[model samples]
Target: MGDAVGRRPAFLLSVVVIAVFGLLSAVANNYGTLLAIRVVVGMGIGGLTIPFDTMAEYLPQTQRGTALLSLSYFWTFGILLVVLSAYVAQQNFRLLLVLCAIPCILSTLVAAWFVPESPRWLLAKGRSAQALDTLRRAAHVNGHPDAVSLFPLGMKLKAEEPEVKSFAVICSPQWGKLFFFLSIVWAGFGLLYYATIMLVTDIFAQDPAERGEADGEGVDIDYEAITMSVVSEFVGLTVVMFTIDRFGRVASQVFTYFSGGICVLLLCLFASADSTSRNLLVVLAFGSRLFMSTGSCVTWTHTAEVLTTEIRTTGHSFVNSMARVTGVISPFIVQGGLPYRTIGVILFIASILTTIASFCLPETRGIALGTAMSQDSTTAKERTGTPNSQEMSQSPATVSDKEVV
Candidate 1:
């Protein structure tokens, strides 16, 4: 687990990625330009998430869930902004895109100006004096007790003992396990979630040859579709927020994943018929979005909490990046937005990935950040020690003194 100290970089990284995506979107020209920009954008976004998971391990256990939930509210507000724009700002989507970028860039600047470095990272690096100062700042902000209890650990005294590895190390020995699993799971999550939400438009487009037969209002505006988007995007998130607190993390996530899969299969099976299929697809789409959002939101909460504090930003960045990468591809695949039977197949595939990944992850509803990192079993952990013990022992705490050799 990490302390408030460990959470700093991840937050700062998130701010940077958000701004970068804005720049990419602003500059993108063609489909290919947008695609390449998205990949780079995804990686930068991915880099930002490391701190959330890591910070969970650092705080007092009772508050971890609450803190994460509050963090989620920030994300939800971003989504809410999108929903509002889509509903009210009909003609200026491009401007909306640019506006999103502005905040991200501003966020990065604010982080640099105001936010302090993570005390945990300092301790892990063996910068005791610096870490202690950070610790005081954390307590002052949160009104927590002055935690002199920070472990005796420090970064290696020599500094050269455990040099941070390069990307090749992330790939070779680690095989980027964190990155890979997160990518796969996020692929499913993104595809499933977005597909469920957008399937209405897909239905309209797919059956457009029969547009004369598409609507009830006789005007063809497809109000059911517009209404569904609103209900699912804005109203549903607000509704789920309260339930999230009641249901907790694991239960809410799995329930959403399993139910979302069922919703998709139901839509495909029922919508196979012609006449009644359209409206039914709308209803099913709503259901899927609600359930899928429930799962997706919960997963975000879980993932951000489950990783070790030390590597939280790295781990979060990887997963989040994967989600964006998939989002970029999902549209093309689900509707042959490419040349394939993307929708049904992609949904099932996503279902399986989330099911498998969800099972593999450790449950961390109430765990502290410090404990989480000490117990981490990733490449760094086997090389160092468990996350909990490490937090207690002193991390990036002592390089020369605790060198593995």
Candidate 2:
């Protein structure tokens, strides 16, 4: 994600195309057409998620999660804002797609102007002097002073020459364990997020005969539910940012999945309830998104944080891409069922996968960005028993989601 090659115009153009896919989705005439559009949207999103995670890895550890969390907020805001914009444009249906393209075009312009080159990339290429300058620039972006301590100081480097690690290099035995953890975590992330959003529309669009009228009772229901769902994601990201370091990565992620599971399961009960219960279901669905994303952001940050610099971007790109495979199928799996309980069951499956994966992980609350953990090395043990201290001083503080936001 932080690689210099990723900053080239070609990759940026690909991201723009992804936005175009989402922009055209409303005009899709059939299920097949819409499904194809969504796949395009997912691919674009997959592209975006990687670069952003790489950005976090390139920044200082103290600011890494917060920086990434803020990006998620902007991503949330974009989703929420776009839905609202699309609804307005729907008044003149043909123009809505054009309006959708406006934001993407504008973002492309802005990114070209200000998205800084990755400092970590420069370091990997043996451009140490330039990398140091890039670090100062990043500190300025993060609202820190450009003084001596602006960039982290204790990081040790072993690479003597610039060598680009191939994607296949990612699967070597040393990096494979982290790679597996990221894959499972990202799959669980993709399923929970996409299924819930996809089901929002399906649940509201009951049989045509049973659909609520736009009057007091309305079939504008899908719009209503999806809008709230987007808003809830912003709120979710906010909660994760404040408490992410406090709760520790493992605790935050586990809470998101286990608690999100309980919240989504409430939908099953609500599925059987009266109209008032149905109304409550909307809020519950929104809350479920909140928690799921909360964990997703943390999980992504952890994945980027724990891997050694040699394989960091490879690990990130791999997980983000694999996550899309689950995302492409999740919508159909949930929507194909008659009862919405089917969706609840699928989410429960994702939650369980995430929960089990969380246990296989270690807490990375204060770990520095770009440093790798050695779980099997006894002499390198850090803060194993000190749960209450700021961080164990025995060893120097060591290094170590999500919508693309």
How well is each residue in 32-71 modelled by candidate 2, as lDDT tens digits? 9978887776666655645665566465556666777777
Model 1 worst lDDT window (10 residues)? 155-164
Query: What clash pairs does model 2 have?
Result: 72-405, 213-218, 296-401, 300-401, 368-399, 368-400
Model 2 scores worst on lDDT over the 10 consecutive residues at 396-405
- Winning model by lDDT: 2
Give residue 315's error in model 1 in angstroms: 2.8
Q: Name the Cα RMSD for model 1.
A: 7.6
Error of 1 at 126 (Å): 1.4
TM-score of model 2 vs. true structure:
0.80
For residues 35-104, what per-residue lDDT tens digits would candidate 1 score against the true structure? 7766666656654554455454345554555555566556656655665555454456566667667667
